[model samples]
Target: MNECERCVTLTTELQKDFIKKECYDKLFKQYTNLEKHFISLEVDNQLEQESFQRNNSFLQQSIPSFDQLFEINELKAQSQVKDTVIMKLKERIKSLSENLKEEKIKKELDEIETINIELDHRVTKLVTKNEHLKQIYKQLYDSIKSSCIRSKEQCDNLIKQVNIKSAKNSDLNASLQEKALVITALKDTLRKLKGKSEVDEAVTLHPIDPELLKIDVAPLAP
Candidate 1:
């Protein structure tokens, strides 16, 4: 009982700083224990009233001050309101942060899309140019190849003509050499006959027939 009444007494420090909710709750819990003990003590009082009646006055004294209880309730209300406000602020900040990140991502994506478009255009132009150059190169290569083949055929024809002309020239030279040898032999035989006739004066010469002396009587080599 004395302990319960001592808790109810206000300290000078509590008067200066004002009691917080935690202190009020602790005091209130102690008060409840004291009340339960008093109820039990009351039952004992009925059994022996004259013995505990003098101690029963401490129950009314042990009740916490009403002002302290009101302050505790006010403090708890203020703390709940502050916590709610802090939660709302945090949610708002998170929302703003998410929005900023999304915007950054969207801007980067736009840049990437633009780059892709430029790259696609460049690639298309390069491919078209490459194909055009390939066609021109093919045509040039074909023309060169055809020209080379034609030139080779012309050279072959010229070589064949030269060979034929060389063969004909060789045959003509051989025929001319045979004719020169026959003419030389005939001149030598005529000279020897002329010398013999001059030495043999006793033999009379016979007259030749006109047909035998004719220009076409004997044919020389053409």
Candidate 2:
């Protein structure tokens, strides 16, 4: 029994030591987890402070002072208005650009119209010149035709005159030839008659006085 008591006391002491060691281990784990949680919270707080300081520095740079704070609020309202104004300005610029483009297009169209008018005027002038030229050409053609007709008539008249003159000349030549033949025949007949007359005169004078006959015969022979 005394050994059993001693064994029981030893087991109780070992159990208590094991319970203390377990409690120590549980406390150490809790402390380590708590330390880590504290470090994370501290780091989070530092990050938040740094973010706040950065925001405060930005505000200070952007806004000048206490009165500037109110000015900033007013400016914020003005900024909203400015946004509307900027949008309106953009719209106005767009409208102005469109107007300019339209005006330019209209001007170009007017220029084209003017050019067309000038071209039309030129065409009209050319047409008038062409008409004048046509009239001149017609006059020239008519004059040439009349001159040709006159020249042809003159040529016909000249031809007729030449034919008549040729006919007259032929008739005159025929008459001259007939007259020449007649003259030649008359000359021959007169010569024959003269010879016969001379023979008869010699026969008739033969019975006359010989001296008278001799004187007449000598004159006739000469």
Candidate 3:
């Protein structure tokens, strides 16, 4: 081809390659963004799961204390009710007299006695319930404690696995360094061979001058 045709062909090829590169770059960017989006989604999901697990664990650990607090509050309310009853009884007894209407006082006393019996029943029921709760709490605590022990054991196992992986990584790094050295040696050998081949090509391409090829022979003397 002529010089002009060759130049045009080269320019056309360059434009074609440039267009291909632009398309490839845009496609690569889109692909990269998609991959990054997937990774981000996975990370978010993992974080949410971890957060939920933490909240669940914290609630489980605190359940017994909440139950105890409720029990204490109930006991306080019962004690307050008992104190009020006793104060009313004292007030009634002090106000009672032979002329101050005994029937009215007796009716009030009967009502108070009935209330006392109901209060006693309530106290007994509360005590029984408290005991039952204590037993249930103990059982739940034991189960949770054993589960924590298992989790600790699993964590220890994971640590051991991590240590083993670390050792393997060290071994792999050593092997990589040894292979790198071998590669460097091979590169040096390849460079020497290339130089030798280039010299051989140069010699083969350009023959020795006829004048330089002619040798002067010296006569052997006796």
Candidate 4:
């Protein structure tokens, strides 16, 4: 009985040691897999951290600083102000140009009116002179037609004088015709000027011929 008991005890001790060894082996294997998984996760975390740092550095380099952004905004505001000022100046210049043009037109009209008045005065003088010449020519013609001849010598002398007087009268008639034409042209110009309110420099009257002003008013001898 004692020997049997000793063998039973020894078998129990051996079985317990084998079970502890099997459990220890299984636990060690599980620990090694968990450690490997933890090491892989750590490496992945380090790589992610490095990628985050690079991205942050690139963003910092690409984005503008606060002071530079402020300067850009200031430049945009200044450009808008300059544009507004230029627009106002352009409007002001247009207004001034219109005013100046109006003034110039008024000045030209005044000058034209002054010239018209002077022309009227000159026309009156010319008309008076023409009427006086017509009267002289009529009187000379009547005197020559009513005169009676006394002798051959006196008739010949009278005929010669008449011819000379007739030639002079024809010249005077031509001059009067020229004066009439000038008066007609002046009247036409006055009509045109009256109709039109605006005119350029070409609207001014040309100078009259000086030769047309001379009148041969000398009385004819009978």
Clashes of each: 0, 0, 0, 0
Candidate 1: tens digits of C-alpha lDDT, residues 147-170: 999998988887777766666666
lDDT order, best first, reads 4, 2, 3, 1
Q: What shift in Å separates residue 181 of candidate 2 from its native position after superposition?
A: 1.3
- Cα-based lDDT for every prediction: 0.59, 0.64, 0.63, 0.65
Report the backbone clash tally of model 2: 0
Give the candidate number with the greatest lDDT: 4
Those runs of model 2 whose alpha carbons end farther than 4 Å from true positions after fitting are 1-72, 195-222
The model with the greater TM-score, 1 or 4, is: 1
Query: How high a TM-score does candidate 3 get?
Result: 0.37
The Cα error of candidate 2 at residue 21, in Å, is 99
- Per-model TM-score, in order, reads 0.51, 0.56, 0.37, 0.33
Query: Model 4, stretches more than 4 Å misplaced?
Result: 1-64, 143-222
Worst 10 residues of 3 by lDDT: 213-222
lDDT of 4: 0.65
What local lDDT does model 1 show for residue 35? 54
At residue 8, give the lDDT of candidate 2: 100
Residue-wise C-alpha lDDT for candidate 2, range 101-188, written one tens digit per residue: 6755775687689769978997999999999999999999999999999998988887777776666666666666666666656655
Report RMSD (Å) for each prediction in the order shown: 28.0, 44.1, 48.0, 53.4
Between candidates 3 and 4, the lDDT winner: 4
